[model samples]
Target: MPVTPQPLGRRERNKQEKLDRITAAATELFAQYGVDDVTTQQIADKADIGTGTLFLYARNKGELLLLVQNAHYAEALERGRAEAETIPNVLGAVMAIVRPIVECNRVQVDNGRFYLREMVFGDPAEPHHGQALSIVARTEEAIAAALGRHGPIATGDAATTARIISAVMFVTMAASVNASLTTAAILQDIEAQVSLLARR
Candidate 1:
């Protein structure tokens, strides 16, 4: 059996609550008003925290975007897993595990820009960067699990195959964003890649 982890201390839990409040407020504001138009003071006000206190969690609006986007990405990954379970084919399964996140980015394109920038180049020491990597890893695992259900090509060596598939998914998403392509086009490209990969 897996070991149960220890619980966070009271102080740590309180800190997490504060972070959650700020992220939730930021998500609402960013979604409703767009990231560029939303101010840090507005976020602080929505969170019911002092301006200075909000700064303690995130240095500025960009970092605040990271916090909010991380939460959004995590939720998307969970949704992807549940959705993936209903699909029967590897390509469709992979799409089920990735489409939610792609659509989330599409819905929040402005923040998606900043979020992708940070994901590629932000300081790995930062909390959000680390958290984002963990979320991506989990997503990769989900993709791998779906592939495992369909073919020996993936299940024969799950870890490396998963990473490769995840990389392909990320590349498809990045290309879609950079080229301003429709989601249908992006999924078509992904299907092509997975079809080729599945045959190998």
Candidate 2:
């Protein structure tokens, strides 16, 4: 007779156990030595697992970095989207979209900084380029829809406004990537810049 499979609960517990070990090791290693400097063998040793075991969790360090970055962005985006749904005004909605990204910098500035560096300016060999570009385009489209729904932007073209909004967000994200500024301070600066643009 064939061997019986494990229960779902047992399988899930096993998976979580493995993931916990991997994530914990990754955090410690990445914090101490940075992502690029940390090796698969080192991560496995840190986690008290074999190199083969580490491969079960992550294909490579680059993949691990993508996981860390995507997890944060997913959380921030969910928070921002939920908050935006609560506001009625278009500008408020726009601000809602920005607020989560800003809040990320407030709570995990170093994490945000690292992600921005790898994402916006990392090597062409990086794997998440398409995903990052998709995110940028999606965010701009969301803003454009909001603008078109509420009132005309000064440009009168929602698509153009969306592109402009995307550019502004990109620039702000780049600036804060390596700077010492707080999220609230960055948001204040953005508000001033946007106000000036509106007045023109």
Question: Which number leads on TM-score?
Answer: 1
**Whole-model lDDT values for every prediction:** 0.81, 0.67
Root-mean-square deviation of candidate 2: 5.8
Measured by lDDT, the strongest candidate is 1
Candidate 1: the clashing residue pairs are none
Q: What digit string (tens of lDDT, one per residue) describes model 2 on residues 1-200? A: 99999767987898788777888888777767777677888888877888887777667776666555565566776677677677777777777777776676445555555666656665545445445555666666666666665665654577777677667765775674436876777787666655444333
Q: After superposing candidate 2 on the true structure, give the runs of residues whose Cα lies further than 4 Å from its correct spot.
A: 1-21, 27-42, 51-63, 123-129, 153-156, 176-178, 196-200
Worst ten in a row by lDDT for model 1: 170-179
Candidate 1, residues 34-149: lDDT per residue as tens digits? 88999999999999999999998988787888888887789999998998899888778888887888777767666776677677778888888888788888987897788788
To one decimal, what is the Cα RMSD in angstroms of model 1 from the true structure?
3.6
Candidate 1 lDDT score at position 87: 86
Residue pairs whose backbone atoms clash in candidate 2: none
